[model samples]
Each structure stands twice: as structure tokens, then as C-alpha cells.
Target: MDRLKYLLSPIKIRNMELANRVVMPPMGTGLGNDDATVSEALLAYIRRQAKSGAGLVVSEITAVHPSGSVSPTHLGAYDDRFIPGLRKYAGAVHEAGGKAAMQLHHGGRESFFLLMQGEAIGPSAIPSVVYRQPPREMTLKEIHEIIDSFGRAARRAREAGFDAVEVHGAHGYLLTQFLSALSNQRQDEYGGSFDNRARFVIEVLEAVRKSVGNDFPISLRLSAEECIKGGYTVEDIQTILPRLVNAGADIIHASLGTHGTPAGITSAPAEYEPGFNVWRAKKIKEVISVPVITVGRFTDPALADEVIARGEADMVAFGRQQLADPDYLIKAKEGRTNDIRICIACNQGCIERLMLEPGSSVRCAINPETGQELIYPRTLASTRRKVWVIGGGPAGLTAAYEAARIGHTVSLFEKEEKAGGQIFYASKAPYKEVYDAWIQWLIFQVQAIGVEVKTHTLVTETMLDEEQPEAVILATGAEKIIPPIPGIDLPLVCDAFQILGDEVKPLRNVVIIGGGMIGMETADFLIDKGCAVTVVELLPRSPVKKFASHGYMLHKRLRDGGGRLLLGTEVVAIREDSVVVVSEERGEEVLPAEQVVIAVGTRPRNELKEALSERNIRHFVVGDASGPRRIIEATEEGARAAWDI
Candidate 1:
């Protein structure tokens, strides 16, 4: 099949015309400045995505009313005060030759710290399991007010020069809550049967259509299935589609799962493959006459093309994939697919920002210039500098590539004859092969940028002094910590890092000490290799506490994959063929194993930094070499250091 047949085709939706079928779906960026104003940084971020050749760019979820706000810094279409900034955002997208659409939404019970001042409001007084708080039930007057709010928001969106407006009626938000029986439980006109449950969204869509005229495109994002027992199913959505079309929804953007069930929402592995949610879209598209846009893990352009070519979706929406590589469309158009950075689906950088660092804004794992588009541009300097980078890990490779791109003659050193650092081991786990692709991309990028790479070559202070032309970057990375438990030096004992990295291979019946991210992943990897794995942790819930919701999902997969997890248990002794652990509740227990794999954290390799400091050389230590942090921290630090140089 011709992959680019439909994807490269120009499509017209209402009055708005798109150059292609690629759509950058609305995702919360959390990059707005205080007072809910769009900053130049946010504008540049969206412009870059549009410039990257997306057919359409959807703005982040914008609150239709003050009570619908999810974050204080989130973009809002509620007030007239936001129109000017949104106009600027629209101009940026239009200037980049892409249609801009604003997504109008109400958080309902999902409104976190903002909106109701930590309180939640919904169609009914049902408590959300995700939030653990019951929402204030909306009265008939309040419902009418909300419907008007949506219309006003749509009018504001049109005034802001947006090409189209998408009503977010999915993902267990306000309109979705009204549509689902699980969340809505109301006896009023907006509850009970499917038609009553879908009434609020239908009315809101009608109100929006009435406000924006017949020519303006009004799309509805609906969950085909909540993926919960009592929630709306695909059949229910199929039944309601005709009514929604009658109400005024020009396009049906189909998505799945509800926010109430984290597992269902985050880990709903229907196909457990890339672009897995396209099947749901295909199901919806078959019955609907209106155009259907499918989102959820549509990373690969070829796969996205298949979805459109096979008549599964009229438009393909990319969320995190575009986050990773905003210029993905442009790269594909230019036949530079290899240069496009693929998102590994590790939500640590993107999704975690929504929870832990709400005000900091979302960013990509590989692209350091994501939210910093106003500050960082992909351009070369007027003059070139000679740069030497030690190590070939994520941080080092990133630094070398950035330095080379900025008109620098970069030389990268790797002592191990390969790159990837500790990430090489992390990727060996089951279902984590996607991570290896990232490492490959990094190496490819560094090489593509004309960076001179030296493998199996150690760089020391003397080497730095000898090659002293400009700056030196130290990215030596971290080493695994070997605890001094009794009989820890047994022949059968091994480091999880060493084993996963293929430096050592154990026979069977492995005991992984420390139930952290690495330990759990190692257990899963070992189990796949036909080993009975047991994980012992001193923490109450394993050190996977630091992991994001997606990581927890991966952890659950490991647990269900036949690996025994013993949380709140400390390993006191390691025998040649067994491990003794003290559980907080179950007293002492001896677990038999053929091999003991220790995954108990890591420490910074500060020796290189100390040497550099002693030599008084111009240098910066990044990645695990500075501190045992994640790849996001490493890549950020590496790019910053390289940019500074």
C-alpha cells in the first residue's frame, strides 16, 4: 500500500482546510504564566509543532468557565481577557501554515487544585476514585449555565480566530461524566438511560453550534467505551452517534477509558502494541458518516497512514509522539523519518509533570527544546568551537549532538565501545525494547551531526589537557551500588545491571533485592526468560513509589507475570543459593534462588569530576556522573551544559 496516500492528501473540514491528515491533539502543556496568560514560550512551542507540518494544531484543554479549570496556569477560553493571547496563538499557527483549533473543556470532578479550590463539581454527587472526593451535584439552573458557558467559550474561540472548536466530552471530564452511568448516577434529565446520560453533552454541542453558526466546524471528543463495567460501551456510543450528529457534532473524535480507573485509563492494553487505539476508531468510523479522529499511541507515521488508508480514521491525532518530536510531520514529509525522535512511551517526563510538577510545564524525553522553544532554536552559530565530550551515554550523546549542531567540532568518547549507558540494561526488560530505539536514535543523531565518535577509548584529565581546544563535558555516568549484606560476595550473587547488560547471566530461580523500578523490571525480564523471580524490598510499596502512573502500570505487569513481590521486607543475608529476608509483618523468611540479583539503586561517579576539579579544567559533569538521576534530568543537564559552552 502507498503509505503517504491519504496522509499527504489535503482535506477540508467545513471552512477550515488542512494540508494533511495529521493532527496535533490537544494536550495539557501547563506552560502558561501566572494569571492564566499564554506566554511567548507557549506560543513558540505551538508554532514549532505547526511549522513541523501538522495539518492542524489543537491548543491545550482550555477551561470554558472558572469552575472548569484544572490547573491555575492552564489556558482558558472562559474569559474575554484570554482572547488576545489566544489570538496570538492562532496567528502563530496560521503563520506556520496550519489550522488552529481550541479545545473547550470542563474538568468536572477531575478539577485538581484549581477551579473549585480543590473541590470537584459534576452532574451528580458521585465521588471519583481517581480524586477520592465527591463532586458537588449540579442543579438544573447550573446545567443551563454550563451549557451557556460552552456556547460563550465557542464564541470566544471564534473571536480568537480559531479555525475550529472541539468540545472535550471525553476522558471522564464534565461532559463525559454526564454521559457515563458510573459517574453520573443522577435521576434528573441528565442521567439513568443512555439518552438521558448523553443529554448534557448533546445540549452543550447544540448550544455551541447555535453560537458559532453552521459554517464553523464543531468537533466532539467522545469516549467510545469507558472500559469500566457499568460505563458506556461501543454499542452505546454507536447508538448515540446519530443523535450527536443530529445535535450538531460535525466530527466525532473517538477515545477510550475513564479517569476513575487509572489502570483502565493508563494501562488499558487492548492490543499492547503501537497505535493500539486505532481499532476503536475503526469501529466508530464504520458506523458514522462524520469524520472520525483516533488518538492513543499513534507514534509511527506508517502506522498512522495505515489507519487513514484503511478508512479507520479520517484524521490521526498524535499526543505524546508529537510531544517527543514536534516536527515529526515535517521530517516525514522531507523523508527524514530516521531523524524523527520516537517517543518510548515512558510517561516519566510528560505525564509526571502533570502530577508532581504541575506548574513547571510538560516536556519531551528526547526533545529538550519542547517547552523552551522561545529560548532554544534549532540553528547553528556564526562561529564554530572545538568541543570534547567524554562518554557516549544519553547525556554525552545529547551534548555532543547539540554542540555539533551549534557549529562546534565535537569529539565524543565512549570507553565501552558503545553508547546508552545504564539505559542499555533498562531496555533489556520485557516490553521495553522501545527504549532501545531511543538509544539508537541518540547515537544516530550524534553521528549525523558530524560529531567525531571514538569508541573503546578512555578520556582522562591528561587526554583533556592534550585535546584542550575549548570545553570538556564529563558524562561518565553512574555505577550500581553493591550493599554489604552478610555473604553478599557469594559466587551465585550478581548485580541486576550486570545481568541485564549481558555481562553476566544467571541460571534460574533468581532473587532480586530491592523492589524498585529496575528490580521489578529485572524480575519481569527474568520471568520472561523462564526464571522464577522474587523481589525483596524494604519499602512499604517498593521504591516504585517514585515512578509515574505508567511506570506503576509496568510494575503491575511484572507482578502479574509470575514474579513474587515481597514489599516491606529487608534482605539481611545472601546465601550461595538462597536469600534471608525480614518482613515487617511476616517475620523472617528464607527464599531459595539459584542466583541473587541486587538492584539496590546507584551512586554518582564523582571521581571524574574530582579529577577535573583538581586539574582546573573548564568542565561540567552531567547525567549519572553528577548524580544518579533519570534520563530526563541527564538529557536536560547535558543540553544546558553544551549550550552554555
Candidate 2:
């Protein structure tokens, strides 16, 4: 009678009873204190997700050893001193009517040498791709000490009120380093052959089980495929799965691909489908009786339910989805799926921030309240008023919807027929249609809140003067900045907007003037279109250097697709069949191309500033119109502006 209600069904793992099959997988948010013990921030974040009505919430990686800590803010369970804070975390989850688990972690060779305060140690000497450390081989004594640490961590987890304890065996952590043949090159019992390679994990599991006893539930996270050359695959997991289960693992939480492997930094990249790793979980499910928790971009509740309905996975772990919308399960159970914010898998805020930025706290691009759980909107304004939001981009849409939700009569005006001004073209890249989903949600929320959206209507100062709104939010966004080089206006030359929109059809050989995110994304699109794309930039390094993860993956894809990049080059002029450029390395040069695309950057379109000033209207500005920035800042400012009005 109901469509896909199985996602709200109950489940059990050993001694722990979950309210539903929905599990919030462990995703580090840098919420803990400097000592890596639980802080109020971590408690608040866990409480928010637990309040979402998930069946289970697995707190982010809890370091079992000092060297295992990823950052100063990573959660810790290595000693009894950390038990009190962790107890509070588990208690809050219990108060929210959800089961909680603690994932014991040890980075092994993947450890940050600088943060570890010593040389990283693994099963064998291997170079760390993430921390750039030359790790030494671990001795038998060190191996036993780490095993004892995991055992102690599990004991602490049980004492701290956790319903279950999960071993962070995946993600190229200590256990994985010993499991993967590429990383494990030791001659000891902890390395070499398949059985030997798995010995370390088995020992840790045995120690943990010996400490927690048979009554406590135990889970192990495993990577079904390493996605790296000469690395393990699903067959490896098929064999490794039984070893873990036999070693007292009551549940198998199957995650996909290892970090620092060829798969890149994110477990769920933007290119992956909603249940990309469900097939892997299914493979494990076929061989083992233990419940398998499948995790990989399972954002859509319908898709999540299908995984269980078809018997693909026993549980669905929503990591980024829960971060984007803490009320995801609650909304779905209430038959209000439309109210749930889609994750969209834009790594800009979550994983990208975690991997690239040092000491960065995890935040959501769509949901600004992710890490700020303690500071919530108290109440919507009781006094209603007229509100005008200019431009229907993310900022304007957010302001309009938020204002209306605050009991304001709001109107949003867009010059284009559709909303998502810049995002419209930005989403044209491969597998980027997810942005459209976010835009759709924004449109739905604004319409549901009764915000009058006047699209294809350009509002001027005269219109604002006549309406005389109590508040005006200017989100006009920005415009592409065309360099003042000679022949810049040539028909053969166009900006990334035109190229992405297919307005200016790219020629066989194309040379772009910029190497920023917009430029690189456009270049990637052109390279896929069988065009020879060459990006020439004025900077010596990547212009989008701040976007470490995005820049790394994007540039790699472009280069792999036969794209050429010329950094430290300045465009002098755009000719009929070639573009003249100058670089420090190569003083003067002619880059022959049929099309010269300009993607240097954008300049703020604040023309409405003087217009509103003349009208003498009460106004505020946000988003690109204020200054070109990311979606998070724009949306946050929009919501803040609405509350201020």
C-alpha cells in the first residue's frame, strides 16, 4: 500500500537493536577538542544526526593510538581518560532514540608524520601518499602494542555506553595497510601470503573480542575494492570477509575503495551513483550471514529503500546525506520526502574540505547548520513584512524562501526564465546534473513557502521604488571578466559560459585564458567532446590552488583526456587562427588554435548598488553580487539577511 516504506523498517545486529535500517556512517567532522577527546561540538553533531531518526549513528574515527589521529580534533578512545566525554556522546544519541557505535582507527603508514610526532610505522616500509612520509616496518613488539590499543579502545567503547564497536579496517588504515599486498611487504607473520596478510586484522579482532566478550556487538568496515593497480578486488573481499566474520565480526559494513589509492580521496566521488557500492555489499552478503552495511552516495530514500527491498544490503549508511540533511530520515518517514535536502554529492564542503584544508572543520554546501548544531534558528519572525530578493540564483532563492518561512511576503525576480543563474551553466559538466537537483529543491522550497517568483522579468530601481518593500536582498551575481587584450571581442573568442552553454561551439584546438575551477571544468568538458584543449594561465601555479582535492582530480582528468596546460603564461591577443602569449619560461610564443576561450574569472555585478541607493530603499546584498564566492557563503548570508530583516 505504501511506496518503498521498507527503509523505515527495523533491524538488529547481535545485541544492538536499531530502530530502522538507516545508519549514519562515520565521517570525520573535526568536531572534537584539541586533545582528540569528545567536545560539546562533537556531542551536538552526533545529537543532530541521531535526532534525524536514524537507526544507528557511528561517530567519526576514534583514534586508538596517538599516531592514528588524523587531526588534533579527531575523536579518541585510547584511554580511560576519554571515557567520560564519549559517554556523554552515547547518552545524547540514546536520548534521541538511536543506537550509537564508535569506530576504532589506526592510520598505520597513512599517518601524518608531522602530526604523529614520530616516523609512521606500517607492516612494511612504504611511502605515504597522503602525509608524504617514509614509513618504517613495524616490529612484532609494535604490532602487539597496536593490537592491545584496539582491544583497549573497544573496551572503552563498551564502557562509554556505545551499543556496538566498529573496527575501521577500511580506508587504508592500519588494518588495510596490512591487508593490501601493495602496502604489506613484510616477511613476518603479519605480512606476505594471503593468510599472513590477514593475520594482523585477525589478531586485532581477536583482541577486541576478548576484551568486549561475546555479548557485545562488533562491526568491521572493509573496502570491497582498492581501485588501485596491483591492489585487492571484490574477490579479495570475498575471501577477506569470512576471515573477519570468523574473527568475531558480527556485522560487515562494506565501504568502497580505499583512500590514497587510485580511487582518489573521496569514497563517494561525484561520478558515483546512489548505490555504487551496493553491488560489493551484495557480493559479501551472498557469502556471509552477517548484515552488510552498504555505503556510497545513498542519498535518495527511494534508492536507499531499494537496496534493502531487493536484498542487496541489510543496512544503508548515509554519510554525506545525513551531513547535508540531519532530518533526512524523519522527513521521509513523515511522507515529506520533498522537504529532505538532497546531498548532490558536491565534495566542496565535506570530503574536499576534510582532505585538502589543514585543520578544516566539515560543513555542508547545502545545509549551513551542519557543524553549527548548537546555534539554531530560535523561531520565525511573528511579524510579517514585504521582502524583495533580486536575482534568482542560490543566494536570492535562499533569501526569498527563508524570508517567507519567517512569515514575510517575499518576491524573487530573475532576469532569466529559470533560477540558478551561474549554477545553470556550471552544472553542464559531466555528471554535474546533481546541481540541478539542488536547484529543483530550492525552487520547491520557495514555491512551498509561497514566495512569488517572477522569472524572465528584470526588475529595475523604478520597480523597487514603486513596491516600497520593507527589505531588499540584492543577489545579482557576477559577470565574466573579459581581458583587455587586443582582438578580445573576436567571434572566435568566448568565455566559459558560452562554451559550457554550447553557444560558441568549440573548435578542434582550443586555448583557454584561465585555469581556475570554472576554466578547468570547462576544459574537462571540451576534452571529452574530442577537442584539443590547452589552458594558458598567468599564474605559475594552479589558480584554483585553494581547492586542493577538486583541483587535483579535475586537472588529472583533463590531462588524462589529452589536455595541455601552460602555466605562467599571459594572453596578449586573440588572432583569427592563433593566440599570442608570453611566459617567463618561454618569453614570447604563439599558441595556434581555432578557438580562444576566456575564463579568467568573474567581476561582481553591483550595478544595482547605485540603483538601490538612488531609490533610497532598505536593502542588503549577498552572494556573487557582494563578491564571487562558494555556495555555502552565499546561502549562509541569504539566511542571515532574512533573519536580520
Going through the candidates in order, what is the number of backbone clashes in each? Answer: 0, 0
TM-score of each: 0.96, 0.93
Candidates in order have lDDT scores of 0.82, 0.84
Per-residue lDDT of model 1, residues 1-645, tens digit only: 454778878888888888988888887888887777788878888878777678888888898987888888878888899999999999999998889889999989887674346456898888776667778898899899989999999999999999999999888899989998888889877888999988998999999999999999988988878887777788888888888988888888888877765554532332257777778888887677888988887777878888888888999888788888887877876677888898877765676667567567877767888877876746786667788888888899989988888888999999986877877887898777878888998898899889999999988767866766477788988888999999898998888888887888767788899887778778877878888888888888766752355465657766667778888899999887799999769999899989999999888875767766767777889988888888888888888888888
Query: Which parts of model 1 are misplaced by more than 4 Å?
Result: 1-3, 114-119, 263-271, 377-383, 546-549
TM-score of 2: 0.93
For residues 1-645, write the lDDT of model 2, one tens digit per residue. 465577788887778888888888988887789988888887887877788888888888999987676677888888899999999999988999999999999988776733356667788787656666667788899999999999999999999999999998888888889998888988878788877898989999999999999988889988777777788988877876677888989989988666666435345667777887788899999889988899988887888898899999888999889988988877876778988898977776788777777688888888767887776555778778888999998889988987888688999999998988888887888877888878888888898889999999898877877778877999999899988999897878888999998787878999988998789889988988889999998889887653354466678888888998899988888898899999999999998888988898998887888888777777888988899987877887887788788
Candidate 1 overall lDDT versus native: 0.82
Worst 10-residue stretch by lDDT in candidate 2?
A: 260-269
564 Cα displacement, candidate 1 (Å): 1.9
